[model samples]
Target: MAPRKKKNASQIGSVSDNLPHNMGPVPEIIKSEIPAKALKEEPIDSPLPDSPVAKELVTPAKVTPETKKKAHKYKLNYEQSPFPDHPLPTPEVAEEVHRLLSKEHGQRKAPTKVPPPSATKSGCGEVPDLLDALLRTVLSANTSGVNSAAALQGLIQTFGAVNGSPNWHAVSQVKPEDITKAIHKGGLSVVKGKTIKNILSIIHAQNVERRDALLREKVTGEPAGVLATSHLTQIQKDAEIARIKENPLTMAWIFEIKKDSEIIDELLKLPGIGVKTASCCLLFNMQRPSFAVDTHVHRHCKWLGWVPLNATADQTFNHCDLRLPSHLKYGLHSLFIKHGKTCYKCRANTNPGSADWKKAKDCPIEHLVDRELTRKPRKRRRIEDSDESEGDSKVTSVKRKSSGSTVVKPTKKAAKITQSKPVKATPSRPLRASAVKARAQSSQVKDDSESEVEEVVSEYDE
Candidate 1:
């Protein structure tokens, strides 16, 4: 079927240039008002008189399709794909109309601010339990799982019972000055000391019943903020995560199916969170699959030409989400940050360098990843070759000595006996070859010991 063209931004139709010198012979009223000196011819070298009609040269353009198209001043949308061979879907007018109407209706009635994170039953999937979520969040920050697990185990061993959830007093009992005893190995205790206290405080503020209320309440109003209290340890959402979670332009905002402005207001109400934090949180927590581009992510995305160089972090994230895949968004966010940190050129904030920018699959993202799912580790290719080569090399290196011992057929036990036979009582000065054999034996022993440690199981009170 011939593709129907909707109105593009091309100029409607070319109007003739139709330039004329005189419409009414320089109007009689202007002639009457002219002074005699003004009517006199002016000298070219003299200061020119202030004439009302000071004309500048403008060549009349020709009227061909090319000229007409140029005159109309049409250019493709910057975000639009420009390859003429690859076409995109034309938007349905009815759907477009419905979208516009829904937007208009929302604007007319929506609140100026996001109501509190009213209690809701669903979101972020069957989300991790609160405590588990916090552990994951904290563990995820600037560290690895093995270390984070070590820290959590340490905390549990000291403070909590066998089940590991701390009682209110369990948290309160840990002296602020000595909180390091609980999280020292964590290496994140510099700030985590306060985080522990904060969690305890929330525990205090939210009695089991009140906690339920907070989680379930659908009330749309001002947020209570990260509920802080003297009785509580005072852990609120950090300023960073809260800010990113609140962006009006964020997918969460869209998911909330509310006005962009509404979600932004609710996010700002968070104690520590700001715009950037809210934006990030909205994508990460809400699973809206946004780019959630942070500072590191912002620099790298643009350098790869996936986005404009001048874009803000949020813009970079939005542009990427639009262009990249769904499963890949979060991975892209984390990987970009990792890549930015690892590859200096990608993160060059002040002094720039040329990046060997690769595009997305079509070299579009211009890097190993733009969205998270784009990154897939390469498969090991040389394993079979390595095994074959190693076997061949060993066989080749084993030459029959000139002493040319006869190949004697023997039963397995007899062959083993011959191989294990002791050398004759030759008087030995310390042999360098023996020392090498001894060193290899000792190294093998150490490798076995280390492997045992890796496979070690705890003999603990169950």
Candidate 2:
């Protein structure tokens, strides 16, 4: 193979000119928006720093080389792909959105906002109870924050051994129909109730399997159910610690994995868990850097042109999480939600006539998004009514002349164009009866002359 030639400066410049307008590294203007001073300051006081440089400097001593490789998988660049093409939002747009939104909503402090003690017990930087996170997130689906909270409260009130303790043990024993009646106020009670029961059943079954496996290895003589209480005094505590641990392996624990592939597979198998739900669990519960795409995020992503217009919520989630840096995921997710709710211009649809729409036209980020595609409802009017109709007139009725006298304006010439009657096309001239007969006689004479000429030629040839 021949060595490849290096491109000339002009050739490189021409190639770049052909690239999409948005395709390039993040612009300097966006970079300058987030100052070096601000980037250095940690939002929350912690052992580790959020800044990429600082994070590398203070890398955890326990993070093995294998863990480092696992982390690299999540840091994959999703913007460019060879096997399959996928569209993703540019870093500059994400940065711009973050900067503007953070100015309005403020940056999210690390040790992400925690739920109440009843909802969660994990301290800052620790993994949350997966079951609690799953149930709470499931309740949050397709409902307002207030309603989901109420539903969660109702479930605890009914199934919890005491008020604050979400006793999964007792919950596992409860009947499905009974669970349904308890969570009736959460909306989609039947579905949610069945989901909760199914999750509990899955956990219980997995726990039983783990216990049976422990018995086979250590407590060989004991029966399956009895192994839960079976004592293995002879075994070294360190030798059988992982296998003999009493806590059952549930889907929540499954999400603790560092590998994205395994975690995704296990999450999708559970009831009511989609890409959004799974990503949320990974971010909040597992303290991973996965980004979830809800309605607000999806709408903003589309408006920012980070995602294609027809991209689904799940596709947006995958595209974003894979491409976005780990540190920005949490803050950007919050900002997207905040901006989507507050920024009228970035909203999915807005009426042009609305006061909010008028105000949003001047938004700073207007140039960044597809401003022309702002959807507005067309005015309903009768076609039978002429444009000149005083009742149907859309513009201002008042007109002023140089003399300072106000007068009611008459309709323009264009207005009467629609009201004017349309003209019919003129008919073509028809051939008269005498003209037709004379034309036919001339044609016969011409044919007879041609036949005589042919006969004279044949006589000459003979």
Candidate 3:
């Protein structure tokens, strides 16, 4: 036996083969007409008719909640969501962004170095560790480091011993108060006095026996005693220079201090020997390994835009510890000082003249924003000449005169040229001058002959 085939929906004549088409289709029927609601008057639009309908024959409007509920639910899907054009963020991408702003979880940054290219340690003469501190202190007094240096230089010149480290120290040791009365021409006496004393004391100790042990160890001498003995030689040299320059006999007294284990520590213990001073001594005096940070160098570093501004000296130290290579530190520190002193200046908001000038100026955005806002753009304008004449060239519409009264329309301003123009100047001239003369003569002769004939005729009649 052959297998039965399935019937297609369109091929069916009746739903169950029980109803006839005239009565109404077995599965569907339409019993009424519907009017469109396009009419403005609501009363003319008819309500739709009711009808038994097959699922396929029903309009969407005819579907009821009950019929919809009975219909099977179906789902549709494509390769992506409905809005295939735009993409949504994924979890992993979002997670990466959160990590970057988390600064604390990140690595520590190396210290930034700014050079003080113009800062002059050369001809300007460095203060001894102690005198440098004192001068710098005085320089830092009520004014900035720069001002103090100016005052210190003024004091040095006013006094006679302005040659070098030894002479400068000699001058610093005397109380500026002692001489302010003598001249009253110099700087703040009592203040300069304390500062100078502090500097001298620092220099005195640096050359003596504190951390001098470490300094002397730089040589390839034996471990313990060899270090002390080498420092002994340096002490002798410093004392000799001091005595030869200022205190002629102070060397003998300084040798007594050479008995200690560490010259650098002893030097640091002096009145003005803070870290900067100590660092200065290790760096400048003994030429040892140490980093010295002063205001100019600190500020110049910030101007380089390498480090954030407002970094403290200690913070700068920490930064340098990380970033600066060990060997370059000595030259770098001095160069930074030089550059800052020579090139940097604190400028006002209105005057940032050059690169160096702007280094210590206020925030850059300040003037720029203010200038852009305060400035006005220039406008263009047109001027009219009030006295100028205007011509409106329209022809007149009123009736005009005939040829005789045509105002003889004097040919513009040139019409009174009678002396040069011929008379009877009509445009058509078919007759020649000779033809006009001949015609007049022939007419006279004919008139005479006619008169003669009339006379003869009259005589015969008589």
Candidate 4:
């Protein structure tokens, strides 16, 4: 490498001076000498008035802090629901329904308050374990209370009970077929059994994971385990199992959630749990304020004009949950069920001329409902047979007589056949015994085939 000669100070100064003239003034290389706190305290520079950036820049308005929404302790508020707009029934209407139902079908007292998890005891008045309550609700789906109770009893009898509760863990271990047999009386035994089995399996799996995690933490003094070992003694394991049996399997974890929405969300993650099922658990089991719409509730709410005509049970629940007062939730739910079951006028699928309908008195809330929206009874027609003879040809007629007198004419094909061939006019005479017998046999065979087809159609309908 060659050594470079050093330039004079005057030459360097001359070059620097010429560079500025040729390419505008050179900007100073400023250093940030101010402390971080001082820089933070300094106001930010605004764009120059004549600059394009200034023209594009906008002065921001002073930002005020948003007020935080106060959360409800037990009830959920759906701020922006997708359901159609409709006002909920007035509190007076709800009260009236409750009062009327209480008179008709004995009054029921629902819990008015929900205790904290720490104070809650697993018993009649207190909230039940999540898993137990869920299982009972599942059995109650589309079934009468008596059948659901019977099914629960059968489960307790077969799998055995601990502290008056069925041993769900034992039930989980058995085959789904066994569960089906146990709950056969509840109806939809196969589907209910599978759903229950799936739920138990999921809960049991979660329990095993928790147990393993606890074991790992205790044995290794670390968050995770390095090796699988029987670190917990058999006695300790048995004690934990017994504790689970005494309490609900999911109670340890699920009850930790404080928000009603979170609890409902967690429940909705289960196999057979829907909005209605989850809400039922919240209202009845957790004693939380929730509107759970069943088929009966949905029908009644529609008739009452509280919800839109097209609203589904789930939509009704969501709409009513937010609109109805929290205090009335339990009472309204219980009363609605009672009224639907006992009141012939309000009951679903009630025929107009049925024994129950004929005996039922006027409904208490009949004036409140829109009678036009209710299902009307269908008009039945009476069928009659007629035989007419024209010359030697006999015509058989089957007529259906309704409220109005109208005779059924032959079909187009029959009419066309009659027009195509004209019968000869001849003197009428008594038919031979063999000919009459043959004709009778042919007619009987046709009636038998028609009856067979009608039977198949009815079976399919069922």
- For every candidate in turn, the CA RMSD to the true structure comes to 26.2, 32.1, 41.8, 14.5
User: Which segments of candidate 4 are over 4 A away from where they belong?
Assistant: 1-77, 99-107, 112-127, 211-248, 352-359, 374-407, 411-414, 417-462
lDDT of 3: 0.39
Off by over 4 Å in 3: 1-150, 153-159, 162-176, 179-189, 198-267, 300-311, 334-462
Name model 2 segments beyond 4 Å from true: 1-88, 112-127, 161-165, 218-252, 359-364, 371-384, 387-462
Alpha carbon lDDT at 1, candidate 3: 100
Residue-level lDDT of model 1, residues 388-412, one tens digit each, is 2333332212111124221223334
Residue-wise lDDT of candidate 3 within 366-454, one digit each (tens)?
32122222122323111111111123112111111222111112232233464477456556333333333433443344322321101
Q: Model 2 over residues 351-435: C-alpha lDDT tens digits?
A: 4434566767355566677644323323321211121345535542333233433344435543465358554545633433433
Sorting all predicted structures by TM-score, with the top scorer first, yields 4, 2, 3, 1
How does each model score on lDDT?
0.39, 0.58, 0.39, 0.64
Predicted structure 2, TM vs. truth: 0.56
**lDDT score at residue 382, model 3, on the 0-100 scale:** 14
* Model 3, residue 290: C-alpha shift (Å): 3.9
* Model 1 stretches astray by more than 4 angstroms: 1-127, 130-135, 139-150, 161-175, 199-286, 294-296, 306-328, 334-462
Best by lDDT: 4
Give the clash total for candidate 1.
38
Order the candidate numbers by lDDT, best to worst.
4, 2, 1, 3
